[model samples]
Target: MELMILLSLIGAVCSADITAFGQFMISRPIFCGPLFGYILGDIYTGLWLGLIVEMMWINAIPMGVSVPVDLTMMTILSVVWSCTAFQGCQEAAIFALALAIPFAYLYSEVDLGGRLFNTKIMHWIEKGIEQGKEYRITQGIFIGLFLFILRAGIAYFVFFIVGGIIFKQVYSFLPYEVVYGLKKAWYYLPVFGFGAVMYNFRNIKIPFLRK
Candidate 1:
């Protein structure tokens, strides 16, 4: 359990680095999921979950103004939690995936905060230019990265530690009936998510079979 906790904490920091310091693209589940999975020793499940999310949200890009969802943090946290707690259990996978949505929303808030922080940096940049300060742009980038990484790392650390304890205690009392409901819901959520994606694709360029 100690190793499990340590691994999760480390993964969270690394995941933060994806968008916070490194290229934003690597934050995608394609990269981060396998990372959490590898740490938890359940690479297969992590990879599959990442793949599913990647395809389902292929169009959910962060355009100039559009925020979309923070799928990378979602993948990282979900994979870390699921891999640590559930291991290779399908039921746990479903639960983690469901839980990830709320965390994704939380991450969105964090990202928004980062953007707001950038506004302050922007003002500083303006001031720097007026005063003939060199390399304000680089300083701004570093500050942006720092704010993003700090928030993500701290948020993840708290959620996993505090949330993990509660999750274990609560799940211990989960009745079979409730578990069944979760299973049913789990089986269907992906269908809806994937269906929406497929619908979008078919609308843009109808996919078909030539029989």
Candidate 2:
């Protein structure tokens, strides 16, 4: 449990880095999933989860002021729940992904609010500039970044606990038919994910198909 908590916090920081500081691709599930998995001592599970999420959300890009749902948080929460709560159950992993989507949307709202608050910080820096205090620029950046990490960390920590409990309980009550379906989806969903990825990258058209 402690290890899972730590991994969730780390996941929050790395995910935040994508937009907050680094803007590196590390926020993508391809990187984020395996990271939490590795930290939790289950790299393959993480790899599968990451691949599924990356493909499923291949088109989730932030354009203009529109914030997409937080895929990174989804990946982290799903992976953590699967690894810790279910521990290598493919059906549980799929269920975990299903469970994480709503939470991801919640985080998206949080992210939007955070950005709005950062704009206020930007105003403070602008005012400081007029007063010849150049240090406010650095101060604002540091403060914004700290808040970003804190917000993400806290969200992950809370969700990891609550989500894990819910995941275990909900999964335990699932009927055998539902569990069987989830198991099948565990393999079949990836094919759909890959197809979605390929379609996004290069829409392959059949020769006989009418455009």
The number of the candidate with the highest lDDT is: 2
Per-residue lDDT tens digits for candidate 2, residues 1-211, read: 6775676668778877667877888899999999888887788888898999999889987777778888899998999999987787889988999999999899888888999999999999999999999999999999999999888888899899898899999999999999999999989888999888887758566778866
Error of 1 at 53 (Å): 2.6
lDDT of 1 by residue, 1-211 (tens): 5764575556556556544555556677777778778877999878867876776787776657667777876777677777777688656666676677787787788778778778999999989989998699788877776666667667777777666666656666878887787667645666766876677757463357433
Supply the TM-score for candidate 2. 0.91
Report the Cα RMSD per candidate: 4.0, 3.5
Residue 142 shift from truth in candidate 1, angstroms: 1.1
Backbone clashes in model 2, listed as residue pairs: none
The reply for model 1, stretches above 4 Å from the true place, is 1-24, 181-190, 204-211
